[model samples]
Target: MKLFYEDVNLQTFQAKKTDEGTDQQGRRYVVLDHTAFYPTGGGQPHDTGLLNQARVYDVEEIDGTIRHYIEGTDPLLETVHGEIDWVRRFDHMQQHAGQHILSAAFENNFNLKTVSFHLGEEVCSIDLETDHVSEEVLKMAEEQANELVLENRPIETKWVSQEELQQYPLRKEVAVAGNIRLVIIPEADYNGCGGTHPTSTGQVGTIKILHTEKQRGQTRIYFVCGKRVNRQLGEKHDVLQSLTAKMSAPQEKLADAADRLLNQNKQLEKTVEELKNQLLTFEADQYQDSLVKAVFTDRPVAELQKLAKMIVEGNEEKIVLFVNETDEKLQLICGRSADSETDMNQLIKSVLPLINGRGGGKPDFAQGGGEKLMSAESLLEAWVKQL
Candidate 1:
């Protein structure tokens, strides 16, 4: 019989146990006769601990025995004492037990069996066999599951003969084996499993189903229970408080206030564009000749681009010159006469380097950006003189 077959009393002592050692790479691991540490199996992670006071960093199973990987500068030995971290062990207890209760509830309420289960660091989940169940129905199932937690129902674990197991209702697919280990949640459910669980449903505390999504004809439920519920609630409260403060609105009015502000900002932008167009008409009157239109401002990029387009439309022979400032960076846009004999691209390529920006379009229009705002005015004035 395996050591775990002696009955899993987590508090039981296995002192000075003899074990085997093997080296795969440069590191060695020990396989023990009996282990209280759970192996990584059934989508649940393995346990970590100290073996004879050395750090046992990892646990895994090979064949039927549990192996412990210890990290240190010590030589390998045949026998050693080990101690498991009880808190981590208890957390696994809560999660695995909660999983069984919830899984059983789904089977009883909707007749859907669990297809897969994963017990992770922050959350645990189960995949149901059906995808089409409505939200209200899933909520009903979750409520029923929590009711069991409040009821504090008993959970029994035992081994039964293959012939005897056939006589009772079980949830998992039966394996062709000599004996089967079954976890029974009394009137709630029964299934063949190997992971550790709590003694009763009440220890699971509250369960909250955070989300549910469909995958390959199955519904996967993401949930949290016990202390995890408190942690999640704390995070949500913090987010709401920060949003309220940043929006400068009372908690109840934050959403509406944000929408109003956004709409007003957008309306102001439209009004400003109209004002810019009106200003461009006035600037066009100050043109040096029938062809030269210079509109200079330290406005934003959007305003500068709009003014440039207005200049080009006013006269096909128009030479549009623009300069703007944003984030201490300078931007320049130049649009020349479509019938001009001058090479505007060649002119820009020579002048743009003075402002440390690069831009080239057709022989008509060019745009550029640079950090050298101090020398931008001279560069623009010099380029316009030649054009």
Candidate 2:
């Protein structure tokens, strides 16, 4: 006898142990004559609790037998007490029952068929046969589902033979032949299910559709029910309040305030970039008649590159060598005038080994960096001596 089927509300029961065995992974498990633990099946997770004081971590059906995978090395006695985790069990019940109501509402109102379901840790989802579900259709389905919940309709379960299936208007055909369990909500839905559910629709509390997306040519609707709905609302409200305080704008004006701030930031960035370019132009003019060789302490590599480019662009008759020395590494840039016979690439390569660096460029320009073995001025002197 299945205790869960007999009474879903039965949280504790006594059962006789049938056998104990180990699986291929060396995990110990026990089988009982009767169990209230629902095994992992039909997209619902397995029930977890304690058996004879041993923690039951997993429950699965193998070869028409329920195996309770337990923690600890305790052996199972002939008769043991089992207690189900009521909080987890009741949450599953609410979610499973909510799924039925929503699935039936979709079918009754829009002919959409539920092809698959998954009850996850934070949310649950149902995959519908349709390719797309509009916002209007989603709202309509959600509204209808909550209406049934508010009505507190009775949920009936029956064990019918294969021949007795034709008497009810089943939402889908039954897959099993014998001892088929049909979960029915009068005039709303009739479907074959083995998962446990609540006795009345009102127990489901509330059903909220979070969102939907297309998956493998089907639409998967993400939703939550009961206490989870309240949890989701609380989380979202907290986030909104934080955003409003940080932006110094009310909820209604938050979006517009954000857009304006972004635009202003963009304008400021443009002005700063232009000022940097002008400053580089002024510095390049200082070394117009000779090779521009300079060393900076803790300077950005990007600034060195820009200064090298500006020096060559302003006066193509001069060679430029810029070095930046940071505490951890060395950076250098070399460039020459277009008319210069010296190959900047060859000159840079000959001196790079002194600092254990690597770089490559055209015959007129090159740049690279590596270990900070030598002083910045000494590195610049090596490049100049090669020239």
Q: lDDT for every model?
A: 0.74, 0.91
Clashes of each: 0, 0
Give me the displacement of residue 66 in model 2, in angstroms.
Answer: 1.2
| Model 2 agreement with the true structure over 1-387: per-residue lDDT tens digits | 679999999999999999998999999999999999999998899999999899999999999999999999967789999999988989999999999999999999999999998999899999999999999999999999999999998998999999899899999887789889999888888999999999999999999999999999999999999989999999998988999999999989989999999999999999999998899889877776658888988878888888887788746577888888888888878888777877888888888898899997888888888898988888888778886
lDDT of 2 at 320: 85
Find the 10 residues in a row with the least total lDDT in model 1: 1-10
lDDT of 1 by residue, 178-233 (tens): 66788888788888887777778887788888888898989998888777878889
TM-score of every model? Answer: 0.67, 0.76
TM-score of 1: 0.67
Model 1 residue runs over 4 Å out of place are 1-12, 15-27, 76-78, 240-387
